[model samples]
Target: MSINAKSADHSPIDEDAEQLARLGYTYEKQFKREMSFWGNVSLGFTYLSPVVGVYTLFASSLGLGGPPMIWSFLIVGVGQFFVALVFGEIVSNYPVAGGIYPWARRLWGRKWGWMTGWVYLIALLTTIAGVAYGAGTFLDALVGAEASTASTIVCAIVMILLATGINLGGTKLLNKVAMLGLIAELSGALVVGIWLLVVARQHDLSVLFNSFGAGGGSNYFIAFAAAALIGIYQYYGFEACGDVAEEVPNPGIRIPKAMRMTIYIGGFAATFVCLSLILAVPDYAAVISGQDTDPVGTVLSGAFGAVGYRVVLGIVLISFVSCVMSLQAAASRLSYSMARDRMLPASKLLAHFQEKRHVPPYSLLLACVVPILVILGSIVSPDALVVIVSFAALGIYLGFQLVVLAALRARLKGWKPSGAFQLGKWGVPVNIAALTWGVLGITNMVWPRTPDSPWFVNYLVLLSAVAVVGVGLIYLFAKKPYTHSDAPAADAVPPSGSNRSVAENAQSHHVENYL
Candidate 1:
């Protein structure tokens, strides 16, 4: 277990360096350890923002599973708690800036780590496109008729640029914005849910168990399966804190705590807000019949009136901007961490951290530019965001499963977690449960929502996911990028901008980690 040290000479970064050595590696400690526990919490929470997620995804869940879709909040939340537990244990042992990549490398091997990072990086990029597109759609709706394809595309690009700019300003500014976002998300979601539920609700609590027969069957099993996406997608972002562990103090302990905290805050918030919106939905017969497709807008407008609905929309917009900001931050860190190992394209440039700004400028640029192009694609095709969001969920779930499966493999090989947060007698059982939940969840996300539709229409999510990873593998073998050796000879390479060998001088007691 990691503990707080009182000696003035003992900084958190020093302990961090020692931990890296124990894992058979060296980190030059270029990034600032400027993130607080709350800042980490804000990043994770806003990344999983219930207000933004519920506001955007509630319609699909309602349209497919009717009121019974509300049950998925609890079911997905419980399943994800097991995933979080597994992640918390891994993070406590192998905390690193890239989260799953470095953890998988330390647990399994280099190829495993690279592939994990590959899928995760794509997931983050697509999620940026998805979140920004959702925000743009909402903004257009709020503008009422001035909204056009051009306007939505423009809105998404502008939001993406804003996030990139905010990230470039360094960790302090990022944390400031994170705190602002947390306040907006928590206050807005809770107030909106309570006010609507208490004052203008239309259905009884029992309505939540009714499916309304969306798929034309005695049981709406298919409808429930499709509706599960809303719940599954909302909860996967709790690991953002772990991705930026290099920037947090005492990450061995703190990152684990942050991961669980994110789940607690996000799970309850998503469930409460989802329930409130569903109960408060007006004109339920029309909504169930597909006449009123916007249950969120309907509920808010009915409860708060038209003008007040716009005010709530504005708050939800804050959550969206914050969500993308945290996503870009996490994604850039993954790229920066992997590139620093000379493991990815343009490794030199992507690995270079701006000493003055204390940020990875090139990696941040990659994160921003790719999402911009994705938004442009959305401009060409009106329904592009739907497919993009599906792919986003599929990519994330697959990436997570790889790490979880790696953990189970390690456990089977008699590996024990040396961290302070070991699961003890429950480790094997928990690992099994985590892997089981992951496979089940991934299958749900990738399975065709419209199984009988045209191949392109029904299987776009599956085909896109397979294409991404399959192409990535082909490129990997064709290029045969050398993953730098696990542990460089201690006497071989010198530290960047230093006279001493990096491995031999790995633990310097004097200088700050700001090399």
Candidate 2:
């Protein structure tokens, strides 16, 4: 357990650090190692905040595919669960600060790892803008604001600034509010779900499969897939558990459990709220046809009245604020982790942890500033934000699945899966499933289907993604930033055609190298 940190050989942080050292890199003694078990779990849960996830996109999902989108949640949730299992195995064995970068470097190599962190960090920032923007909608509804583009953007800025302040207060403040946010989320889900289910079950249970002819084109599946994006967005953030892997206690055991629990709890909450609101949607046709004022808003107002609905929105607001706080923390940690490896500009400054604050000061600042700027531009052309978020989802999935792919490659070539939690015989199959699911998910998300308009606008997501990567590559090669020596033994190629025991590899390797 990496609790309040101890010696380089004793405490959980030491345990985690020892694992880091064996991976050909030294652990930087910076963070306070102060997050508790619940605090760490809250880290993932809040990042994947079900209230924020479900409520943010609830109306859109209903409009796109009606009630059947719930099935999309189930599919993505299950597929994402398989991915989470792979992550659990990784975190159990590695348990380091820079979640994907270190894991990928160990499984693949430095270049792959750098690309993984680069994509994932930017994705996180894009999502921060999306989530903060989402919060603005609910806040606007609660406050009876005009809900204009300007008002919504301002509301988002307010929430972002508030969350930024809380994040800057450091993890201690983050943890306390995160737990409270979890409570608010759980209670809100329960109260909202049960009340709507009991008092407002207007539709039959079978409506879950009803597309209601909302499918946009000739292909019904196309519309269903489009709506699935909502759930797809909800499920990916659970991997934040691995992102902040080093800060928690008993991370070998705790981190994996926290990861799984995030899916279990977040999944249940998201689906429950989704189901409750769907059944209570009153007139599905009206909602899908834009005749109703949004099924989610309708259900909340019907069940609790306007005042009571605003009360619920208040809880959802907490969930949103808390979600932003957690996302910022996770994003900063990723930045710090990558910067620690000297992969980014101003690596020294970005990687410097504020010892007194127990935070990555510069990383935290960047985390806030970039998103704020993006949000500002989003205010200008909301479509720009949409392209950013669409690609963010794609980028995150690609980064995460790349690690899974690397692990699968290693597993096939004599790398044994060993951790406090091991998949054993199930490892190969699970890894394969994760990769398959990832490819499908990424394809669906990044596919260029904007209907009408020019090729550039239609393929904006894919185009933007390729452009960013292209630019990043140019920057990478131009700067030649990866010049630092990376603990030389790390890249030592094994003897040609030599067959080494998994046990032997595990030993020289950091898996058993730490032990």
Which one wins on lDDT? Answer: 1
What is the clash tally of candidate 1? 0
lDDT tens digits, residue span 188-238, model 1: 888998898889888889988777666566458888888877898888787
Quote each prediction's TM-score: 0.91, 0.91
Would you give me the overall lDDT of model 1? Answer: 0.79
Q: For every model in order, what is the number of clashing pairs?
A: 0, 4
Worst 10 residues of 2 by lDDT: 506-515
Q: In model 2, what lDDT does residue 455 have? A: 83
lDDT of 2 by residue, 1-515 (tens): 32223566596556555555554556445555567777777888888888887877888878888898998878998899888888888777667776877778767667777777888888889888888877777877888986777776787778777887887777678778878888888898899899999998898888886688887555878888888988888886667777767667567677777778888888888899999988888788887887885678878888899889999999998888888888888889899988877889889999887767777878888878888888888767888777777667777888888889988887776666556677778888999999999999988876665667798887777887897777778877787655653622212223347565322343342222110
| Candidate 2: segments with Cα more than 4 A from true spot | 1-14, 24-28, 485-515
